[model samples]
Target chain A: MSFQISSQPIDLAVLRNALAHPHAGACATFEGWVRNHNDGRPVLSLEYEAYAGLAEKEGARILAEACAKFDLVAALAVHRTGHLQLGDLAVWVGVTAAHRDGAFGACRYIIDEAKARLPVWKKEHYADGVSAWLNCAIRGGFSTAAGPPSGPPTG
Target chain B: MKTVRIQYFALLREQRGVGQETLATAAATAGELYAELRSRHGFTLPADRLRVAINGEFAPWDASLTDGVELVFIPPVAGG
Candidate 1:
């Protein structure tokens, strides 16, 4: 798989090493971290879920698109699923290219496309002893038993 | 009628209390099939909120269905 959804904490070094190549003069990476706050609430943690079949396919497509659009030599992305604590890495992206501009643009393109297209959801656990699915209610999407999601996707 | 595998994810799975199911349907298109599942499962999310995938490829909701295809109804994604 060109992309992965893991239940373990991501190691940046491994992702970096995968892009190692003599032809790659530049590489760019992005890391999404879980923060402690959201829309006036203190977040304790988060639970992430995915439609695996589609997520894998779509993620691979995003990587391929970035490679083609930016003339990249390689690209990789990994997202974490399941409970994540504050400050934990939620997603990681890496792009390698012969030039700096291609690496930068492809890195941004992959992350943005993945955010818009992957079949993943996030549930926010708040300090108020409440947890709700974040942004799942937008545009008539899923309605939580707790009612509407208090915050749109911050990630 | 055609037989297909239906997979639910995110909010739909929680509402339906199921992640996957196999069913025989007389519905000719993905939209019709989704409408049926929505009624049967009482899915809270409406059709406009989802994207349909058949046999692992994203397709229009009106796309025709075939027997033994795998269908997934995607909820709004919040991935980073």
Candidate 2:
């Protein structure tokens, strides 16, 4: 499978090795890390949860689409689940192509589509002791930007 | 009645207090099943805010439910 859900810390070198291709001349990668702050709140940590079965299916579909659209030699994406501390790598996307354009374009497509379509959720534990699930806001309640949630406030 | 395995994730799991369950239900469509469970479990998010998946693929909320199928109610995804 081109896409996978990893519960452990992702090994970047291994992922890069998988994308190596004899005919490819360019490699593009994107790594999403657990940031320390969001919407001004000091995020202490993040928890990612996924419906593993469906997530893998959808994630693979996304990679396939990226390959077709960008004419990539290979594309691979891995998303990390469970608790992650600040600065930890949360998601990684790598693509190889004969030229830079395809590699870059496909890499961008995979990460963007994965974020918008993958069957995953993120919960942010703030420094102030409040924790809330991100991106569960009702329509028209919150902007399209991944901002603060509108759900019942909890600590 | 059909027996379906319904799985919950993230917020729905937290509200339902379980990851999944196999249940017999009279609801014919995915939407109907969600309505019944939402009331039973006091789900905060409504049908409009969620998407339903059947047998590991994203299915329309109004799609018919089949016996022995797996159903999931997906919340707004935040993956990166």
Candidate 3:
């Protein structure tokens, strides 16, 4: 699959193999991790959710765009859903191309676009036993902040 | 008249108190359906804050609502 979401832990090797090609001279990959903090608060964990069927369709479209825009042999991306602990892998994007430039550019392009466009939601649980769903009001300001959620506000 | 299968997520789900519901609506377009639901359910978010999808594909607000179609009101996605 070009792009997908998984509740089970991601297998990096599997995605890597999917991008493997004999002509590929360089590979670039991006991993988004569930960190322990956000906006100066200590985070306990995250609960990720998706409007599943649409998410898959949108995700595949993103990969298709990367293919059309960049000279790449293959590209794939997958996101995680459900409860996740600190430092858990939240998403992965892997791209393979004849050169490092295309691979790197496509990798960044996929992650950034996926973060902005996919129909996925994250609920953050704070260390103080507080929890809030992210993104409902995250467009709190008009800054072009590329994210793994740069200004995600919970609640 | 159309019967739409609506699915809610995140804050919308919490506000609606149910993940999915089937509704028979007189509204003709996706936007109209959302307006009716917003008023009836007191959904705090507006059509501008959410994206509408039908049958697993993103659709414009003015798109026609078909019977038994799966409708998803996607509140701002937070996927990384």
Whose TM-score is greatest here? Answer: 2
After the best TM-score superposition of candidate 2, give how far the Cα of residue B41 lies from its true spot, in angstroms.
Answer: 1.2
Instruction: List residue ranges in candidate 3 displaced over 4 A.
Output: A138-149, A152-155
Give candidate 2's error at residue A122 in angstroms. Answer: 0.4
- 2 or 3, which is superior by lDDT? 2
Give the TM-score of chain A, superposed on the true chain A, for all candidates in the order listed.
Answer: 0.87, 0.88, 0.88
Ranked by DockQ from best down, the candidates are: 3, 2, 1
Q: Which ten residues in a row have the lowest lDDT in candidate 1 chain B?
A: B41-50
TM-score of each: 0.88, 0.92, 0.91
Residue-level lDDT tens digits of model 1 in A1-155: 28988888888888888889899999888988888888888888988998776788889989988888999988988999988888888999998999999999999998888888888888888899988666555344544423433443344
Specify the poorest-scoring 10-residue window by lDDT in model 2 chain B: B41-50
Per-residue lDDT of candidate 2, residues B13-34 (tens digit) = 9999999999999999999999
Residues A1-155 of candidate 2 have per-residue lDDT tens digits of 37999999999999888888899999999989888887778889999999888889999999989888988899888898999988888998999999999998998888878887889899999999998788764455543434434331111
CA-based DockQ, model 3: 0.62
Candidate 2, residue A150: the lDDT equals 35
**Cα distance off (Å), candidate 1, residue B18:** 1.2
Candidate 3 lDDT, A21-87, residue by residue in tens: 8999999999888888888999999999987777888899999899888888888888999999988
The candidate, 1 or 3, that scores higher on TM-score is 3
